[model samples]
Target: MIDKRCSDTELVSLYQTGNEAAFEMLLHRHKSRVYTAIYLIVKDRYEAEDLLQDTFIKAINTIKAGRYNEEGKFLPWVCRIAHNLAIDHFRKRKRYPEVTLEDGSQLFDSMRFAEESYEDKQMFRDTRSRMRDLIKELPDEQKQVLIMRHYLQMTFQEIAERTEVSINTALGRMRYALINLRKKMIKNNIAYDENFYPKRFDQVSIPRGQQGPDERD
Candidate 1:
């Protein structure tokens, strides 16, 4: 019998060596998180279920073909596959949902920029647009951390688990992401304002229950 406490790395290794039960264990352990990730994006239970199955099927095929190299970081790797599949699903349908802020602003989160004039708001919008472009210029690891934390609204601990890194590593990546973004902003002649963007990960507000009072790097 396979130990229920077996690590993901152990389960993956056993599965690679022809133990089908190990693969099943892996699926059982991670299925909920994977499904949730898909559901959050697709916002449809049936569609999330279908994509979840497709995700594991793709992973199974890759493992069978001896191409699985993710090793210890199994969950994050699988989550990324599911994320891509969900994105592709929307792309194929050509109907992407608009993420809105509390005040009905589209695409941008509920960040209150202290703008009092039409010109200021328009400048803020243009800055945000350029910021998105700058984000694309970040290194893949940094970009992934940034998107997962800011856009996905994931907690640091959750980000660490999904990215298969320590909390400090996740926090460090975010810090560097902000630094890099600020550098790009200066290079592009955009003003850097801490009130508009988080200059540090710790300054970003954590949801009430998502983080403890003592949680920090």
Candidate 2:
């Protein structure tokens, strides 16, 4: 198992060296804040989760493409991704009065909004279903923390008090829960959106050993 204590820099270095576990650690460490940030903006549980997965996919694809440049500030970068995506989501909703599938892709061979309850939006159901499946695999303690925090809207202190664990311990369980869930997702090739991202993160093909800093992250 990768050490949970590794700094962001160390973890990134390991991830750059082709360690997916290291990336899982990074995801675990940062997921809650990213989820919370998106939820605060979108104010919907399902859409917030959809954006959360997009943000992670963006970061992961960027890292794999060797475009990730973070001078030890991974969390901020992801949080920014989440914030920007959330803003984009709001703009799209305002600009277009219809609903697209998850990641806001309409199935009429267009990225625009689709008719309500359209069959083409089936991909969104797949996305949510996949996430639900992985969430079921979380350990009992971590599941409690996740439900109380995300579902019950409890703060860390409140969760700790209710669970009779230290705040750090409660936080740790949540982190592990995220990591475990993500591991299952990756294993199953799950994504919140079936469509490829608009960004060029997918087009860049850099091998692991060839990745080097091209700009300040």
TM-score of each: 0.49, 0.44
- lDDT of all predictions, in order shown? 0.68, 0.64
Deviation in Å, model 1, residue 58 alpha carbon? 0.5
Candidate 1 vs. true structure, TM-score: 0.49
Clashing pairs in 1: none
What's the true lDDT of residue 65 in model 2? 85
Backbone clash total, candidate 2: 1
- Which candidate ranks first by lDDT, i.e. highest? 1
Model 2, C-alpha of 121: deviation from truth (Å)? 26
- True lDDT of residue 76, candidate 2: 59
- Model 1 lDDT tens row, 78-191: 876786676667656645335422223221111122123454335446776576557767775676677666644467998687667799999999999999998998899988
Candidate 2 at 189: error in angstroms? 46
